[model samples]
Target: MFRAKNLWIIHLLGWVLFMSLPLTIVSREPDANFPMLVLKSGWFWSFFLVYAVLFYGNLLVLTPKLYLKQHYAAYAAVFVGLLILIYVSQPFEKLIFRKFRQEQGREARPEMPRGGFRNGPPPGLPPGEEPRPMPERGRAVDFVSLTLFIVAWAVAMAIRISREWRQSERRAILSEAEKAHAELSFFKAQINPHFLFNTLNNIYALAVSSSAHTAPSILKLSQMMRYITEEATEHYVPLEDELACLENYVELQKLRLNAKTKLDFNVQGQPDGVKIAPLILMTFVENAFKYGVSNHRESVIRIAVEVTGSHIQFFCQNRIIERREDVERTGVGILNTQKRLDLLYSGSYDLDIRNAEEVFTVNLKLSGR
Candidate 1:
């Protein structure tokens, strides 16, 4: 409920009421004794000077540093110590000035009528004497006020801590979100370079052999380019479009492969109006070609997609070579893809992988929504 500007204004007003007002009010009153009057006025000024430094220095200036922790004990110590110093210094100041006055020729003291709030006398003191007792500063009431003020300050500190905690939590969540987005973009970027390189290799085959399928290969590449530009960036695209792209990719792969390697693909559910990532399945298919199936005799690859109204499942199984030295590999694109899946689907997707029986398999289930 408090702002820095408003709190500062309130502090300034409080200073006027407590310090300036009291000194100004007492100064207008006349005292009964010449020496007593001189002594009292001088004492009030001395107390005010000490009180000013302590109050302003601690509350306004030092509060920023002390705000680190709720150090009520330190605040209390400063307040009580400053007040005690003010109380003791007042009487001694009077004695020193009185001695100075007699040493000079300014000892012609004149008495005046009593007036001020302490016209009778300062409280907690005997009748006119050399050592007068300091008056009550509303002792019991002040004790209660100081207690309440301490509690209020602690409450303010608690509120500040809570606000900072919430802000930090929000920042952490946002940073995680940004990191996931970057990973997704990196994965998407990987898809392009790999696709382009494979297509160029296919084109090289056509140039080397003078095959008639070169024109269709060019057409398929164009379609894939269009998909990447328009639909790939979207979170989801029509399932039919995804399948069509997959079919194009398989045909493109066929251009470079021999008749020994064959691909089996199946679909069980409606691809009419459903949606999915444009290239999520393509990576698995390409991986199957790259690592799963070696360029050898009797190679087989299978891809199946089952799409329901509320969920979708995809499975890929391909044969791997037994004698390959590097059996396991994690490419940049795959790492980026893993991070993307974590952020995009989180708990809504399940992925299982197995390389048993010399056959690599991947099964993934993702929420449709």
Candidate 2:
């Protein structure tokens, strides 16, 4: 399909509309020599031709090459020279028209009156007598030409500068998108390795102990890996899919937990039609299992997910049984998750992490897609 290259197509159409004004003049003055008025009128077509050339040339060439490129002195000098030429050329063009008329033995037409053309005689002219012709008005023509020149210059500059600004903004958006993609890729690389190392260690411990849960743990791990590989890499996934992956991870982690560990995982609402950033809530859940479980004490890890319309809330509260030094070691995952949230959701989500006394909690709220 054909598409417009840019806004220049619209700009060209506007100029064509303006150029058709000569035809309007021809229609209003049917008895006038329309071709001679348009083609031979020194201040009309000459002014339009010069204005058109200056408009496009200045915007398309001089602006990008000189003005936009910071060749301020050269750009100003060239424009000043062009203006001087235009000013001088106006009078010379009028003189050429007069000479042409004289050579053809045609009397110079009277200038339009100050208030513009009137079909009847002036107030002072007697009835049935023709009014004396007005003399050529150089100042009026010059003023009109100058006004047109200024308007064309202003409009061209405005359009060109606006286009350049939009282009710059578009480029900036593309650059930011690329940068965010690279950063997200780097984050995924960090997360996958760290998570795999921990999961593999748990599987190894289970296999070495000749535990009956080893095969089930491996099956759950396979499902978790599939989720991570296929769905987590995507920008968004169905909320149900993410919740299922979380369930698999929680089940796999349960295989290695001590008997005293109390874990409650609950989903409070339907996830139908809801979508969210994949694995966004998993890091908090993982941290709860890592630092909340204890062999000697009653340890509790609570995870809850609530969905209402397109709103989602995730809550994780864990009894912190590890020492302060060990707890600090778990910051990597949470920090990475926070950065991802900031990049992806920015102002659209809220994440609060609190640690008071022996309890650590994560509360996250989001407007899901």
Candidate 3:
């Protein structure tokens, strides 16, 4: 089916579109010398048809060797042969004209065979009756056509290779960028575990000191430390994993400040399959435990998460009950998280932080993968 379609289109569009200039001139020239007009047009058309057939085949046959194998001499030989055949057709033109006329009523216009025209001269020419000038010089026509073919072939090949090279370079650069981002995250992880280890050690000190609430604190620290070290070591974790880690950290803080600290953090959403950066939630949780939980005054921290479709919202609010005399600002957690969001989310996430009156709050909206 494809071959048949190609054949039909080539006859219609290819001949009519590309060869229209010459075909139109021959068909519609207004000069009226009936037999002479047919004679000249027939001879030239026959010669041109043969030249086109050979020239197209020459391109397919020679271009691969010239570019891929760099066979310069083979390219030259092909051009020489093509020039010879095209020039020689000028001499055959008169003969072809005579033969085509003889066959108009002698036989039906020869059925076109495969590649191109299929008719050749029949057997009725005696020994010594040929035209005087047998078309000696066709160098100008031959050179013009051959040079155009070479130029077009070279341009097409260069464009193809250059496009492929640019695509490969773009892919390599993107891969290197991704690797560097992963390494930076690893550096950040190192800092995270250091903080977790110190908190665990503090819990251990409380236990070995045999404080009255040591057992519950030890268990809380165990769960929180497991979550910090184990769950936050991935590119993306489930939303539930992050929430669980946050709750565990808050519980440990509650154990340490036994009945003096309160936390109100909750989540109600699709808890599985939604993906997020593993440690993004921890900075807010850590900040709440550090500065908001007061043992002797009114202190409360509230956190809520809502997820729908590919969007997620995390809201955190904590009272600045233990604000130091000279301290009037948020801490390193929010700053580092701001930088991380700039690096990882860019235009894809929104963050708001406010410290008004005695209350501090953070609201984050992020996209899930």
lDDT of 3 by residue, 221-247 (tens): 677667666766666777777777677
TM-scores of the models, in the order given: 0.61, 0.80, 0.55
Q: What is the lDDT of residue 56 in candidate 1?
A: 51
Model 3 — which ten-residue stretch has the worst lDDT? Answer: 131-140
Candidate 1 — which residues are off by over 4 angstroms? 1-138, 234-236, 272-274, 292-295, 322-335
RMSD of each: 11.2, 7.5, 11.5
Please give, for residues 185-241, the per-residue lDDT of candidate 2 as tens digits.
777777777777788899999999999989988998898899899888987899999
Clashes of each: 0, 0, 0
The list of candidate 3 runs beyond 4 A from truth reads 1-145, 176-180, 212-220, 223-230, 258-261, 295-297, 308-310, 321-332, 342-346
- In candidate 2, list every pair of residues with a backbone clash: none
Clashing pairs in 1: none
lDDT, each prediction: 0.66, 0.78, 0.63
Order the numbered candidates by lDDT, best leading.
Answer: 2, 1, 3
Candidate 1 accuracy as TM-score: 0.61
Give the winner by TM-score: 1 or 3.
1
Best by TM-score: 2
